[model samples]
Target: MKKFNLFKEIIITDRNVLTEAINSGKLFGIRVDGNICYEPFTLDDILIYRGTPDASLPIETIFGKNYQVLEDNDRVLIKAFSNWQEIIGFNSPRATYDDTTADGVDEFSTKEMENIGWHASEFNIKYRTLVDVLEDKCEGTLICIEQEEPYQFSGLGFIDDLADARDVLFEYCQREIQRLINEDEDYAQDNLNDDELEAAEFFKI
Candidate 1:
């Protein structure tokens, strides 16, 4: 549940240089069996560079919208949603004022509750939500989704399906953790009660 470190994985889900990038360090490297391995590293390699034979492109620009890059080099700001346009408004004073009151004292009077109100001023700007940007754009598109995740000491988290790619990566980490624990010859005596150890031994074989 806790990620030790964050790593940006620029995954190429197609037949592109993603694999070569991993293999060559021009893209990324992952852990395997507790060891940092590069591309061409098989599942057994701990640092695996696995993928399909197709390549996908980045959605720098959407069909009808343009994204503004943010201070964060990898992040961008999105103004409009799928169908909704952002609007704003401004508050101003009215032309006429009413001085008649119960105490005969002058008070503030405004038109339309304020001098001027704009729909645009009323609305606020928005950036694409993380889920929206990543999910919507990369859903079924055969492209490489790039984002950061936990770092691994060994066992690569290479995946093909960019959508469920995190699941694949996490699975790799879990398996690697289990492998290391299982490989520890002293693991049996280091932890676990007699009953748990007995059950583990029964299942170990």
Candidate 2:
């Protein structure tokens, strides 16, 4: 039983759109009263809410609100990188305890847990997911909508509903590129020997 309110609820007005989104295996979003309210995730997200009347709010009741709005969470850990190189660099994969987030540990395999020994299932680890980490890193809203293999994206959920995800990412990329360039230029200027710096300054137009 969910407490219902019309002004702030997620309901599907059309079943055809829902079916198309799920069946196409493509990203789909629902706009409620002119705002992007809900997006149907994989089958688990679709059916896991209840046997019937599983509206957007029900799913949100479980996993949407906290991660959707990261500020609500008491525990926020953000990791900083030196530059864009570090942000997009290769990362070595390892075992993770991603059960604490609203999405929980998704699609993690038993074989992947071999390192933890036979007591793995008996021992449950509740910790931060990448979305939690990225919110701290990017300092913006990040959305994850993929139903299958949620972790397949770069960060847990790199999404922006404000505009388009593509537009948002592009803008971020441009800003970071300029920031990195400026950082490198500043480092170069600071590291110059006094004589070189003086000479360079003198040569400046």
Which candidate ranks first by TM-score, i.e. highest? 2
Stretches of candidate 2 exceeding 4 Å from the true structure: 1-163, 186-205
Give the C-alpha miss distance for residue 133 in model 2, angstroms: 11
C-alpha positional error of residue 162 in candidate 1 after TM-score superposition, expressed in Å = 6.4
Give the TM-score of each candidate: 0.16, 0.21
Give the winner by lDDT. 2
Name model 1 segments beyond 4 Å from true: 1-163, 186-189, 192-205
Model 2: lDDT to the true structure: 0.29
Query: What is the per-residue lDDT of model 1 for residues 3-62, given as tens digits with 9 covering 90 to 100?
Result: 111122222222232335434423343221223334443323312222222224242332
Against the true structure, candidate 2 reaches a TM-score of 0.21
Give the 10-residue window scoring lowest on summed lDDT in candidate 2: 43-52
Error at 100, model 2, angstroms? 6.9
Worst 10 residues of 1 by lDDT: 83-92
